[model samples]
Target chain A: MDKWYVGVDIGGTTIKLGFVTEAGEIVTKWEIPTDTNNGGRNITIHIGQAIKSKCSELNESYDRLQAIGVGAPGFIEMKTGFIYQAVNIGWKDFALKDELEKETGLQVTVDNDANIAALGEMWKGAGDGAADLLCVTLGTGVGGGLVTNGQILHGVNGMAGEIGHLTSIPEGGAPCNCGKTGCLETIASATGIARLAKEAIDKNPQTTLANKAEVTSKEVFEAAAEGDEVALEVVDEVCFHLGLALANIANTVNPAKIVIGGGVSKAGDHLLNPLAREFNRFALGRVASGAEFKIASLGNDAGIIGGAWLAKQG
Target chain B: MDKWYVGVDIGGTTIKLGFVTEAGEIVTKWEIPTDTNNGGRNITIHIGQAIKSKCSELNESYDRLQAIGVGAPGFIEMKTGFIYQAVNIGWKDFALKDELEKETGLQVTVDNDANIAALGEMWKGAGDGAADLLCVTLGTGVGGGLVTNGQILHGVNGMAGEIGHLTSIPEGGAPCNCGKTGCLETIASATGIARLAKEAIDKNPQTTLANKAEVTSKEVFEAAAEGDEVALEVVDEVCFHLGLALANIANTVNPAKIVIGGGVSKAGDHLLNPLAREFNRFALGRVASGAEFKIASLGNDAGIIGGAWLAKQG
Candidate 1:
């Protein structure tokens, strides 16, 4: 009988789950809608039921499963797998690991979603097994995960690798959801790029961006690809700040690979070319020489894959 | 007979050596002039001879010395202990570890000076045994070292903790020795603080600073303590940039202890108070909450003590 591990990624809207082998291959993957009712108390029960039903449908006994690894957003006590608060899931001080283990009758490990994604990339994605890696996810909000000496840095309070919250604008910058003003998330994330485009259009409605009903970060990159001045200016501003922030991070930790992922990264060369130039300009001469940039190849599978990695480690 | 490890801190002007026990106590310490003549070729030979002579003077056999650890200022290949360059000592591509091992007939370990100082602080100084720490030395030039998971983070190319080279004033900032402009070294170092004061004094001849023939960083801090408006502004500027840079670093690594050291650290509360405020202002609320700042207590002994730690590890 072959052994299997369950990898779960819990998000606000959906929970992604996968059955993975010891060698990191996903046997099968699926998603279930997150149950936020009753303050998300039913989340673990649903996950447990889903896992059992999937195993039965595949004619596999529950004994074939070895352990479980889970990824969740927000402040986590990595050792205890306790959630101090996960605003998206309406969970506070939740014993996620204990509950999941009880429900599934298996051992479990838990980590931050961003961290697991970074681990996934390190194990099977753009990280290429580099011992030191910096993975930035340019989603609705900028998210980051850092691996130093081949291990995740959870910090003193599990708040390590909050790269998006780094202050890009020291004064009079836009407000961020994190209660800070002018954070990198306010300028470099997907929403930030769209916001920049909106602000530009508000000032001068003469550009090609004005033709769109609502400009997205994708449209901004598209316009820049065609040499639109306003779009180009916005891209330059975003890359300059992002580049400077990354350079500072590189100076601090000196990672060998910087992996860019998430929806905003879909712009591909249009983003990488400008961002790389800025990174080189601001990084120390030697730090720049040592780092290589790569687009994340794992895509949406990163979270589940990363969750699988945690299980594999266990 | 008791065993001992030799710790060496090599500088351009002098080399500090210590005979340390396994328990991290320095039995005796001394200094010898660094032989920078002949392109620093004789440095290792001098250090080896000094260790042997010191043992003879103390009526101890050289056999009692277990191993040696050396700290040098430069870009080092941490694994092989090879020096890429140390401009102050005129050493380039020097095999520091192999040469020292051959000269002394003992195993040897070598690390960057800044890194050793950080490790020393962690072992016996202000770090208070914290596993994750950030130590910044604000001397003639700023230097930094990072300890993660109770080990020094040498990074991919041994350039991990280059905090001083982080770009603070990303645009039109003063040139740094590293060939970058607007580095944190240009605003927060002792030399940088003095430079800021000189520029301010040159622009306004009627200030209290004009009364002094020379305005060093010390004088600037003293004047600020006395509430001189010009000096106050300079102190504020330095702390703001320093605090911001530190906050960014904290955001990345989330250190539990941030140890500030070096000549400029002598300003004490005059520097710590304002710098702490800026650090809190710029750092994420949680990262700020988790960190405590302390002045480095080891002073000049940190380098040799840290070097001893390297030998102890060996």
Candidate 2:
């Protein structure tokens, strides 16, 4: 009989759930709109019911369902699966693993969403089985997950892999949501890119980006691809810092692969080429020689897959 | 009967050796001049003879010796103990562990000198049993070793802990021995400090250091202690880069303890206070909250002690 694991990814708007085979195949996946009307108190109950109904629809015995792995946003207690606070999901001091286990009658494991995404990449995506890997997502905010010796480094306070918060400018730079000035998040994130594009447009009204009422990171990359000098300059500045930060990270951990994911990464080689040039110029020669960069392939499914990995490990 | 392990720390000028118990206590320690005249070919033989002679003198049989651990300065193949190069000792392509085990009828383990020192600290010095650690040594050159999940992270190419080579200046910085520019070693190292002092003196010849025939890092620290304006500025600059690099590293690894070691570390609180200030300014809040910094307590004995730790683990 084939055993199955339930992988759940909890987000602000919706909950993504998948039944994954022991071999990392997604047997079936679906989504449910997040019911956040009551501080997300009914989340576990909804997930439990969803799993039972899905099993019945597939006409599979409950014995085939093994364990559950969840990826939730915000601060998490890895051992206890306690949610210190997930601002997006309106969860505070919630015992996610305990509640889920009680409702579903199975064991559960929980980890940060970003970490699980990295684990997913490591298991069945871009990580390619490299034990030491660094996965950075260039989304609204830059998120990072570091894997060393095939285990996620949660740090002492679960703050490890906070690569986006690295102080890149180091002096008199933009303020970050983390209350720090000049963090890499202020430069390399999608929001940061758009902000930089706005600043560039403000400085030079003759550029192609000046014509667009609202400049997005995608528009900036597209303009740069079309040889717009202003957009190219902005892209250069963004990649320079991104490359330097990634190189420094590679120097410290000497990862075998650096997987770049998220919306801004959709820039493809336009981002990676310049970023690699800067990374080569900044990283220790040997470290640069050892690391290979790849675009993340899993996309939205990374979280559920990584959750399955966590459940499989458990 | 208590078994004993032999720990060897091979340096350019001398080789420090020790007999340590499984509990990490050094029973006895000694040193010998390194025989680098013949490309370090006789090094293992000499160590083998030293162990045999010591056993005879102490009236202990060879059967009581358990294993040996060696700390060598070089690019090593960790699993095979093959030294690809050790420029200081003129050794290349040497099978250190195999030769040592053949000469002395015992098992052997080998690691980089900096890594062994970190292990020594983690075992009996200031690491306090914290599983994840980052140990940085500031000497003629900066050296680093990273521990993740209680195991040394020997990245894909054994360059994981090359923190000193992290590009700090990124542009128009001094060149390093590793053929890079603006590496952390070019600013925070003992040699770099003296060079910075010389540059400061050239610009402002009215400083107290202008009176000295030759200025050293020690003199710079002393002058700063005595309120020399130029010296204080240099200290601040060095601390700024050091703190920024450490903060960035902490953000990546989220180490529990950061152990600062080596000769330049002798500057003590004079160096730590300002470094801590910059560290707090740059590090992510939770990361800074989780990490505790400590001066390396083992001094020169860290290598041999770390070697003993390796042998004990083996």
Candidate 3:
């Protein structure tokens, strides 16, 4: 019988699930709405039933499922698989692995969603064949994941890849959601870019961005691509901070590859070309050219793919 | 007959060698001048001859030497043991390992001096049982070594633990030897402390430091200990920057312990007390209490001891 692995990515709004093969190919994938009410008490039941239904729909036996891996947003105890906190899902101090295992009668593994994504990239995406990779996701907030020696770097408190919280500007950096000032996330996230564009437009109403009723990070990149002075300045400033942050991390971790993912990364070369240039300027001369930069290729499926990889490997 | 390992710590001014037993005890140790003339061409020859002579003096045959480990200041090629560069000793792209191996007729291992020191600490010093540790040597310039999972973190270009290069102040920061401005080394190193004291005295001529022809880091700490206002400010600033840098790294690497070494570390609690307070203030709530701070205990013998550890484990 062909063994199968299942990956579950539990997010605030939706839970994405994928049935994957040992070869890292996703056999099938789907999503279910997340019920965050009652502190996510019904989450395990939903996941268990969904897995059973999905297996039945594919005419596959439940015994064929070799393992289950979950990617959740928060700090997780690696040994116990207990979630210390998942702010988005209201899962505080919950035994997610044990709960899911009991509900489905299957062994389960759990990790941070960002970590699994980096693992996914290393397994079959941009980081293919590379064991040491740093993946930064620029969504509403910036989240970073590090894969060293083919394993996630879960620091003492499972906060190892919290690069978003690193003080980028130190002195006058914008406030972050994490109650800090001048964090990398305050400038590198998609929301952060929009905020910067809004600030710049407020200062000078002559820029093309001033015409937009709602300025977005994508529009800022689009205008910069067209050589708009203000937009270009904004992009340059963003790249400077992001590149500096990457260089600092490179000097510390010396990763072989830095993979950029998230909605903002859609800006492509307009983002990568300048980022690479600035990264070199900040990095030590010897390490400046050591790491290769690449846009993440797995898209939205990265979470599920990464979770499956964990299950397969575990 | 019990076998022994030879550890060699190669510095710009001196070469320290030790004959260590399997239990990590140094039976005997000695030092010799480092002949850097002709681009350090004769360093390996001297090391080999010294090792042979030392064995003869102890009435031990060459057959009793099981392995040899070398600790040099540079980016070492892990597999080949080729030194990419060691600016102080003027060695660039030198095969120190192969030459010494040929002369000694034994298997050899090589690593960065700071890394070897960290290994030594982990094996027998402050980081005695901790598998993950970040050891920083605050000498003229800051050098860091990371030991993760009982192994050195030699990044893609051997730049792992280059925490000294991390930007401490993003704007109007001091220029660094690494061709950057406002590095942690610019604020936390022995030279950086003296520079800070000098700048403070220059601004406020009434301070006692202003009368000194040479303002040393030790004097600044001593004055601070005595409640000298200007010196206290300098210490505060230094602690703030060093603490922030450590907190940032703590969030990223999350090592079990942070061991402080080098000449500047001699200040003891005068440095550690303020640094701990600031580190907690900047670190994420979860990671704030995760790491323990300790003074490096091996003193100058750390290098040779670390080299022996590599020889024993390699």
Candidate 4:
């Protein structure tokens, strides 16, 4: 259908709204500040206004809109259309989907933001046409989605692909938000990489990256590109951890392709090469050979595209 | 659809055959010797004579047979109907489908024995009706299978589920056939448990189980039940590794149910209780609250049932 669909990518501060077509082309998009206070009513109204404003701006009737898809950042109940738990949003059991659907008067589909983003990429990004896929999003937190046999594996509950919280280091690790230690999220996420950079800065004062003011993982990559040995070591170590996680998953499921998304995957071949090498060392034979991982192609559009696909599922 | 079908569980020695229904019910099962050396042609002859004799004994005609489903132990290509690398079977890229079909004049379906056994369980056993499932056979090796939305999750090459080779302890523990160290199979399989028992017996010569003439996993379980300290330690150790592996899989996939089968699972709740407790300790909070696990239900009938189902997938 040529009718437009609304996709909302909910984040801590800005909520990205996109009117995308079934062909995965974004027609128009905008962002609005998320207001969580006063029972999330204002946020619901904002969503409706944004949909109405976009349709009106294009001289199109609201009925011309096909559906609304919300990529809620954390735990979500697709059955009830509620945002169950989002630490960033501070909303528990928030009827975000139901309220949005009621106000917008459109079919609304809501799921974990990362799962939708992974689906987005699978639809038209790096992992297109792959029936078996595992998508890892290395953002503030490591969120993952596993698609098998053309459908997302949502486990018993909605929390099927919680690979970040997997206990990699059984005993010692950095404390995580989920009250766990030594999770993939604690080491491989952009936030985790920054934490590592911060630790290295404290330990090695002679390092070039250590001399930089307010160091970030991006700065670490840049410094590493310029031959900073410490930065290189940090990257290698981080990739080793990521590789172990991928190998563990590979041995179990043997997905056809692993789509790496989020800001960090933009590190490109630098990350991809090491990830492939280390995964080769760890993954079981045939499982490692069967699945080839690639950098997610959709980049920022993965959320919008995957959200549309999720709506199509409904 | 139950005119008659041959369900052969091809092992290293015995070939167990049964007449199975489309509904997965096994009837008039019999066994015959597996002769892989007389050039694959002899296998069909043996299977034919055994089935004919069985049919004559039951006053049924050979013409009443419908199809044949073979469960061969090793890596198999279900789609191509070939056996790739079952070193024990002495078949490398053998066209089992064509050979069996040509000989028997009936359609044939073949797959890795463990995978078919899991399909059997998924179809009619403990995992019946579950949308997503992980089946682990804890025998000499920790063979596994993944079923998502009621279908097997075979990767590009049909080598989808190989969980045994997953390195549970990253650094070092025990050696694996795939040249890995500290794999889940090394610590938790039936062979692993027997090794642990032997090591304990060697170290603690005065212990109750140590004094036994021959130490098997069954003997170890028996000792543990009689409150032998050494037996208890070995059992606990095996279950500990199993718990880690299970939790790792659960955290990654979060399947609806996990079915434990093979020789080791016969220990039942003695092993399952400790395994579940340890899995809870290592699993993500959301997963610990969800994901049901139980012992496999079909027992020996799993092969015939799974084969019948795979044959139906034709």
Ranking the candidates on DockQ from highest down gives 2, 1, 4, 3
Q: How would you class the docking of model 1?
A: high
TM-score, predicted candidate 3 vs. hidden true structure: 0.91
Chain A TM per candidate, in order of listing: 0.96, 0.98, 0.97, 0.91
lDDT accuracy of residue A124 in candidate 3: 87
Cα lDDT tens digits for candidate 4, B1-314 = 34666788888787888987666778778777778784444776777678778888988877777888788876777777877766776677788788878777778988888887888888889997676788999998888988876788786667677888887777767788879888888878888888889999889987798677888788888889888999999988887778877888888877788999989889888888878988887888878777787899889888988887777766
| lDDT by candidate, in order shown | 0.93, 0.93, 0.88, 0.82
Q: At residue A157, what lDDT does model 4 achieve? A: 79
Check candidate 4 and list the clashing pairs.
A120-A306
Question: For residues A1-314, what per-residue lDDT tens digits would candidate 1 score against the true structure?
Answer: 67898889999999999998877778999999999988788999999999999999999999999999899988899889999899999999999999998999988899999999998898889999899999999999998999999888888888889999999999999999999899999999999999999999988799899999989999999999999999999999999999999999999999999999999999999999999999999999889998999999987678788888788778
Predicted candidate 2 versus true structure: per-residue lDDT over A137-169, tens digit per residue: 999999999988899988888999999999889
* lDDT-better candidate, 1 vs 4: 1
Regions more than 4 Å wrong, model 1: A1-4, A52-65, B1-3, B37-39, B56-65
- Report the number of the highest-TM-score candidate: 2
lDDT rank, highest first? 2, 1, 3, 4
Q: For all the predictions, what are the DockQ values? A: 0.80, 0.85, 0.59, 0.64
- Model 3 agreement with the true structure over A1-314: per-residue lDDT tens digits: 67888989999999999998888899999999999988988999999999999989999899999889899987789778899888889989999999999999988999989999898898889988577789999989999998877788887667788888877766777888988888889998999999999999989889999998898999999999998899999999999999988888888888899999999999999999999988987788767777999999998788888998888877
Question: What lDDT tens digits, residue by residue, belong to model 3 across residues B1-314?
Answer: 67888888999899999988888889999999999988888999899999889888988888999898899987689778998888889898999889889988988999988998998898889987687788999999999998866788887778889999987776699999988898999999999999999899989898877777799999999888988899999999999999988888877778888999998999999999999988887777767777899999998788888898898887
lDDT of 2 at B146: 91
After superposition, the stretches of candidate 4 with alpha carbons farther than 4 Å from their true spots are: A1-6, A41-49, A59-68, A79-108, B1-6, B42-70, B98-109, B201-203, B312-314
Candidate 2 per-residue lDDT over residues B54-155, each given as its tens digit: 888888888888999899998999889999999999998999999999999889999999999999998888898888899999999998999888888888
Q: How far is each candidate from the true structure, as Cα RMSD in Å?
A: 2.1, 1.5, 2.8, 3.2
